[model samples]
Target: DKNEKIYVSYDSTNKNCKAGDIEMAEYGHPKNDVGAPIINYSIAYDMTNEKPLLYESYPGSIVDVSQLKYMLEKIRGYGYKKIGFILDRGYFSKANIQFMDSCDYDFVMMVKGRASFVHGLIMEHMGEFESKRACSIKAYRTYGMTVKAKLYADDETDRYFHIYYKAKKQASERARLEADLDRMEAEMDKIKG
Candidate 1:
């Protein structure tokens, strides 16, 4: 099972509990409108088997970004070598990327579109694969192209970025942005009047 893929995600939800001796019950970011104490928990899921491999609960004050290293270590302790992780944008950070590199773990993470590194890459490779039929993924209805580059200027390792684009999504986002701009302009005009 060394070659099996594992997708890890960390999330927490609030639990409404009275003032009691529950050690992990503390106030943190509430995922819902529960006006009570909360506890943060995370699960490491095995993607290949579609089941949870491990779970851990911690104090509510702990954030998900800070738990990546701990979770990676726990997974390693379970004797899983050659691990692959699929993470969300919240886990995308320079330190996390470097740590994963050090551990020799493979990861596919979502990066914020507005990040300067991502923006630069998009601009550099714009239109290269947008219309290329060879890059089209019919099932996902998106065009994907992989580029190998350093995640940071000082990094010694090169990472593979699977950049994807969908024309319909782009058009929809553009329209929404235009509508927001028009609304803001109208509000400004009213203020001036």
Candidate 2:
């Protein structure tokens, strides 16, 4: 069985450009202090084949989430059918969710941060699997991909969510918080001195 599942991931990246190199790009924040013109573009990547399916350029002045609608339509023009999208949490929104559903696309998007329901879910079930050894999983550069998932629905919207309990991810997140607190304390010490 050589048949492979078709999965596409949509992501946008910012690039440096000349002042008038692109028509739509403007002086937008590029997450850097570089005083140069920038351009933003979205690429639909075929994760199964490790190739890019479609790409759409955009004005650099726009944020990533703001370009989702345009990117969706641009890829649709490429005439790919029955393709599923795996998107990052940054693309989560009521409008985006509705748009994907309207387009009849199978989509699996990562949920970000605390929606009230997600928080409640965590509170309700996190204690059930609190040990690192219980859900220890190796993923990417960390042992943190182990997850327990549950289907969730938003009361205010029709969007359904899958909440995951990732122990290694949680550990990594706690390390990040510890780092931030360390930095803040160091700053306070410097100021006091």
Candidate 2 per-residue lDDT, tens place, 15-99, comes to: 8786665677677878664787778877889888889888878877888877888877876776766668998876877788778
Note the Cα lDDT for every prediction shown. 0.82, 0.70
TM-score of each: 0.82, 0.68
Give me the displacement of residue 155 in model 2, in angstroms: 6.0
Candidate 1: residue 135 lDDT (0-100): 96
Find the candidate with the highest TM-score and give its number: 1
Where is the poorest 10-residue window by lDDT in model 2? 140-149
Backbone clash pairs in model 2 (N, Cα, C under 3 Å; residues 3+ apart or in different chains), count: 0
Error of 1 at 104 (Å): 1.7
Candidate 2 similarity to native, TM-score: 0.68
Which segments of candidate 2 are over 4 A away from where they belong? Answer: 1-5, 18-21, 33-36, 132-193
Prediction-by-prediction clash tally: 0, 0
Residue 44, model 1: lDDT of 78
